[model samples]
Target: MDIIKNIKEKGDNMIYILDTANINDIKKAMDIYPLSGVTTNPSIISKENRDFLDILKDIKGVIGKETMLHVQTLSTTCEGIVEEAHYIRDNVEGELYIKVPVIAEGIKAIKQLKKEGFKITATAVITANQALMAAVAGADFVAPYVNRIDNISGSGVNVVNDILNQFELYNLDTKVLAASFKNVQQIADVSNLGVDSITVPLELLDKSIEHPLTDWSVQQFTSDWKKTYKTDKIIIK
Candidate 1:
């Protein structure tokens, strides 16, 4: 079966996003490929060990005004989450997406944030139920922890599929932003499943475009051409 063709038949709305907060990494990755946006949690931000808002502004400066920047709120309560959302918007400029976890308070916070005219991304999602609730709360995107779900003996792709199906059934505007991938295969599988977006690590992004046979074929072709033409450089003049 043609898996790619099958995936296309379902529709092609997938977007590749970078999941990092490092300014150097963002600059490098953006130079290498077209990324829709960048995502960051508290953990990812902590790794940088810089001023929080300054780092966010630096990331915004690197990505520019077009690319979406998703920053998570550390608050566990609805009131605090809403307050943090305003702070993030006040500090970071351009297209922004506020990531709230899919917990009891988070769902409540999402509703409030939506009412306040903020773009919300319901994160830390592991189950279809959480995704469903997040969608019902009017989230712009729902992020499922792919590898993290697998660590708990559940199928991440299945969770993604279930969330997609639920959205289609209800005609919800919330799209799935599949995250926490450890390998390219996971991305390929999720892509085939018709997810709306994916946040990939920079290493996996490089690995996704590489294959042993492709390199081998190129090497063989170059060797044969050099043998016949007796040159390694192409001279236009």
Candidate 2:
């Protein structure tokens, strides 16, 4: 119990993570929302064009140590993945969730990392079996590519549901971290079924939170308030 205490995840509500490496956007989101953390892959980080330490450290500075930072491994071999994990662990100061693809080699690395008490997020998951195998390998989280599955004409939401059901059936503690959202609808669909964690691109997250009716209603309230009171702010009589 003590060995895996820090890495094990159990929560009643979903956790939200920003799937971006844009430092300015991350800082803005952290200031505005109750964001849980940030997630980055090689593709995302490559866009930043900064050294790994500099990019990650800048994110850490904005989000702070309490928030989780999920960084994916570029290696495809178990040995390489383990070495990369160690490198990141030695440099980063926080609860870093190592994102590994749900492949043969990645599963092996996850098992080794789990034993060493590293927080593992098995990413690139498209099937229930892959998620099941990763969970069996003791992954703290399994990230199923929601939109990517749908793009291939598969029901991403159904896959996510199946993954959640399997975890419950097996009595495993691995959380489902749904990823690759193309739209807010995908996020909402996954949210309805029960996602332990979701890393949303800012555009989709913005869509998820905003509505024209919401804005109009707030505008109406402010207009009505002005008619009754001289001050725009709410206060006691």
Candidate 3:
């Protein structure tokens, strides 16, 4: 039997979600790659300078019904966060994942949202304990900030590995979505740890898949072909 190691199912595989609110970038990524979904925060949304609902709708329209669109809440209180989540769910069409910070109030909100059968992603996680707690509280996903942890002289890849260890130890089903990267190498490092997903910026993600060597190789092939045939063609005389 031939064994293949690159099958990527959306829920089970290493999901590739673009972390941007720019409409054009989302569309371009979807067109090029099998993008799993999208994630957005207030900062990312504010960069567009459009009405919040309009932006969400535009993104949903582009991603369609199957792919999820995760939106972060602005409230610090459990009640406020729950109410805000409800409002967003009522307005946003299709599958919407609410992104709550892995804080005290967020844990409470996640519990309530889980009871209500809402898909929740616990964000702003930095430690293994935080991700574990979010998983126990019924968050479908936990997003760890890889580069932010590294900026403070910590190993982001190690932190992600620790989180994965705890989840396996406790047999938690919560998916780990690594976020906040500074470069493409960070992505490779995190993915090496077998993270369930990654939400990357369009610029760095684009850079990750391209190289000067690839362009040079194609140019060389074209040049060699043209030198012999006068044109790059399969027709040989």
Alpha-carbon deviation at 5 in model 3, angstroms: 14
**Candidate 1 residues 82-184, lDDT tens each?**
9999999997889999999999999999999999999989999999899999999989999999999999999898888888887877878788999999999
Positional deviation of 108 in candidate 3, in angstroms? 0.6
State the lDDT of candidate 2 residue by residue for 33-131, as single tens digits.
778999999999999897988899899999999899999999999999999999998999987999999999999999999999999999999999999
User: What TM-score does structure 3 among the candidates reach?
Assistant: 0.93
Order of candidates by TM-score, top first? 1, 3, 2
For model 1, what is the C-alpha lDDT against the true structure?
A: 0.90
lDDT of each: 0.90, 0.89, 0.91
C-alpha RMSD for every candidate = 2.7, 5.4, 4.4
lDDT of 3 by residue, 1-237 (tens): 122223334566778999999999999999998789999999999999989999999999999977899999999999999999999999998989999998899999999999998999999999988999999999999999999999999888888888887777787889999999999999998787778899998998799989999999999999998998799877767
- Give the better candidate number (1 or 3) by lDDT: 3
**Residue pairs in candidate 3 whose N, alpha carbon or C atoms collide under 3 angstroms:** none
Question: lDDT (0-100) at residue 103 of candidate 2?
Answer: 90
What lDDT score goes with residue 67 in model 1? Answer: 84
